[model samples]
Target: MDDSIVFHGPLGELYSQVKAGKIKTALQGSHTRPCKFWTAMKILSGIKNAVVITHGPGGCAYGVKQAYKLTNCRNSGAPYEPVVSTNMDETKIVYGGEKELRSAIREVDGKYQPAVIFVATSCAAGIIGDNVDAIVDKARPEIKAEIMPIHCEGFAGEYRSGFDLVFRQIVKLMDRPTPERQRQLARSVNIVGSKLGPERTEVDTDVKELVRLIEGMGARIHSIIAGNCTLEEIKQAASVAVNCTLCLDIGYAIGTEMRDAFGTPLNSTILPYGIAATEKWLRGAAVHLGMEREAELLIQREYAAIKAELDEARRHLEGKRAIVEGHDAVKALSIAHMLESDFKMRPVIFNFHPWSTEARQTSIDYLLETGLDPEVLITKGTLKFGKYESMQQTERELLEYLGGVDPASTVYFGSSLSFPPVPLVDLNAILNRPRFGYRGALKVAKCIKTALDYAARPRSWLTKQIVFPPNSGGLSSAQSLTSKLAQNLPDCTVYAQRRKGRCMMN
Candidate 1:
């Protein structure tokens, strides 16, 4: 909150400063945020049997496919589908790309015959004013399949904008319900705001846990909006009685649209990470449906199932300083809140970007309202990394922050990218995933216990050298080996001499 541009206190206080517009985007133009085109494809990939046609050069299509499609298929139960493009070139750009876009849509419909074909515009398409919607409308009459156009130009807005753009489109597809049908859906809920459709990373495990809780309370889930759902399912989204939030940062736009359009209620709760939060998540909507007792029973049963593991993890983790980190501001801070209140630890947040905080202000405001305003610490290194820059500075910043702290009493909860000199509860481990509800709580406990139990184990020197090099030092072990190898050769040339430290290498 001061000119130092560094803070080490409650998130609520920091968020207040953020809301007041005091926090500037650090090292502008340095955020490695994905563009709308890439993010739009991420949403489309989650829908079953949908095809996306990029209205740009081939590289845009290929880059997005590699970044979202393949990984989503591997992790989120999505199918592998190639992202095609109009292949907009200079000639097309000079005249117009509409003809190419129309052809691409029809070709895709003939070849794949997908349930939905989303024509996502790129920066080039947007710049050219390609009239993507008009092209889609014309192509729709010629093709049998439904054609939709997403103005997902990379330069149009933040990566998060892609989410709402697709979500609003998804909401628009909803079919209205009769009064009787709406009443019958009084106990039904729609899980809104998904990135990977149905069974993707967060969708698979986290949503499964939500299913368990909802069914246990005698409630039913209508559909997970856009998560591997079919065209019919999206149209039926309006029939749900309540829309339960998976993450309001992405869900709020869809949730509000459904509310206004169909008069459906929305449960805009933060993600239920721990015992208490999960309880709150359930009650946020179930109580309105007059299922308070049922929700309580389910909570008690689930808590009892994991009581032993929770107690054990807490015994080892209590009184420790928890360092929480992630690009996801809400999820990271939610974990921090759980560690503080549930596990009895003090959490210090790190590397949560200010722009991200601004984008997800609604979620952040809700967290503060729930009294979860933990301290946040940011460094210049966290804000200034480009795509190819080494992440050693980030690690060094963390090490500096922990300089005088006790490693034994400190635990790091984040991705496996950083090799902190302390016990690290690796959040990226696939086995301990779905960090939601009681299932997540159990997995988190086991992971924490393991990380602390194996705190004495040595890190792999080889991977460490590749991932995080020394900031200031002589040659590393690999370099030293190369130097020795160079020294042994009698026919060493100028390049070899440079490698052996006999001369400076450019």
Candidate 2:
């Protein structure tokens, strides 16, 4: 409802609608949920030597700070970066808090002395017209760190918009490449849009193998765009011979900006999830760097090492049925194809999106090429179970297609964003490591096997279990409020009205 990029509600109508140019592009849900400030702060978090100062109240800062702490906990054991807030109270809001912001910056710099200071303006600052740029300019000379002002109000746009603004601010950090550094471009490459996780680093999964594949071809990883890299590494990004973007969400924007600014060639292709895709991706990068032979050799070697395990896992995963859902349409599709091809699983429904009709068409073409033609259902962002009623019809249709097999028996692959009525293999839940490359393929196969084993329970077992307490009785206003508030009731029903309404509708 909130500016949908594309909508493909299962079946032949999907093909028709896609062809009709009804949906263009893809990714996360409504842009109205108000997370722009948090998004910007997360991006700034990846900059190792940067301290983010939010020009807003304690509430906004607290949320962003928590997000920082959580993401940092997931990162490569890096110490949490300093995030200071002006804690703008009502008095400061009415009179103005520019002086408070200035003081916060000074205090933060004096304490952290980070190489770069990122000033993140919140919706309050934007509404009050706090000129962050002027304040940064005024404080630039006094602070030893370079100051960067990010104008990302919570109402600015969505997560993607925050990424754009953050990257724009990061661009100012690029130092002009010296003639000597320009020569470094021949063997140097920049990894754009790489992110770190709590349990394992992305480089350990996607970038690690990628680095192996590229460096084997005589290329050096000059920088990982927004990952755990130093300010110096980021500045060197401008001098890299080419840039590779693994995740398309922010990768596309970062690659485009770097290409436009530094004239660095970019490989914004889909991430290498499966064997074939990884081969294609590595070859693409190798060709640009004139290391096609090296790429092929590396691919062959890695494939040989993991092929046995993949095949064994495939034996357990074959004939499995599943539904794939997540933010990136292309990534979801890639995973779907991997399931269909190597694992020999049947993917009945795919929820993904592409920003352009052309991109969607291309994705569809790729799926077809891989012999996967599943029912497509595109969605964005976090899957809000609040819209469960609307999903019921689709759920029934899918269940019927499964010949009444217990929904619990089906496999689900996605982030925490999906709530399929089956054993869900929440990809996002895997915190310790990422799913990528040949190793990742084997890991997924093992997870699918585990999910199938766990889901072999009787279907009625789940339905027979009680949700609300014994006396909760068909929820109605007439029911005494005290009865509904019984201590034994499930904590899941915080929204009594919405949940009851959805239950009745179903």
TM-score of 1: 0.86
Please give, for residues 1-506, the per-residue lDDT of candidate 1 as tens digits: 23323655677777777778777654356565788877777888777778899889989988988876776677655567668889989998899888877778878889998888988889998998988887787788799887788899999988888888988887766788777777777788888887764454544377787987899999998777767778877877787768888887888989998889888788887778887788888988786567889888888888898898688777988888888884677788678867876888888888777776777788888878877778788776666644212355566677777876666788888644457778776554433247888878766766666656656665556546654556634223333343343333222011211243221111
Question: Lowest-scoring 10 consecutive residues by lDDT in candidate 1?
Answer: 489-498
| True-structure RMSD, every candidate | 9.0, 8.6
After aligning candidate 1 to the native by TM-score, how far in Å is the CA of 489 from where it should be? 38
Steric clash pairs (candidate 1): 9-375, 10-374, 11-373, 11-374, 76-200, 197-227, 198-227
In model 1, the runs with Cα more than 4 Å from the true position are 1-5, 19-22, 27-30, 74-82, 198-204, 386-390, 471-506
lDDT of each candidate versus the true structure: 0.74, 0.63
Residue 131 lDDT in model 2? Answer: 79
Q: Top lDDT: which candidate number?
A: 1
Total colliding residue pairs, candidate 2: 14
TM-score of 2: 0.76
Candidate 2 C-alpha lDDT tens digits along 1-506:
32321354543456556577765433325313347787777777777767778888888878876766555755566677767888888988788899998998899889988988888888888888987889999999999998888888888776557866777667668876677887867777777776542324453556776776677666888877676678888777777767787765467777788778777788755556766666766776787787877777777887888888777767767776777763455667677767766677777554444342343454555556555566565443223222221233333333333445664346866532223456656554443334777677766776676556555433322221232123433222212332233322221111123333111102
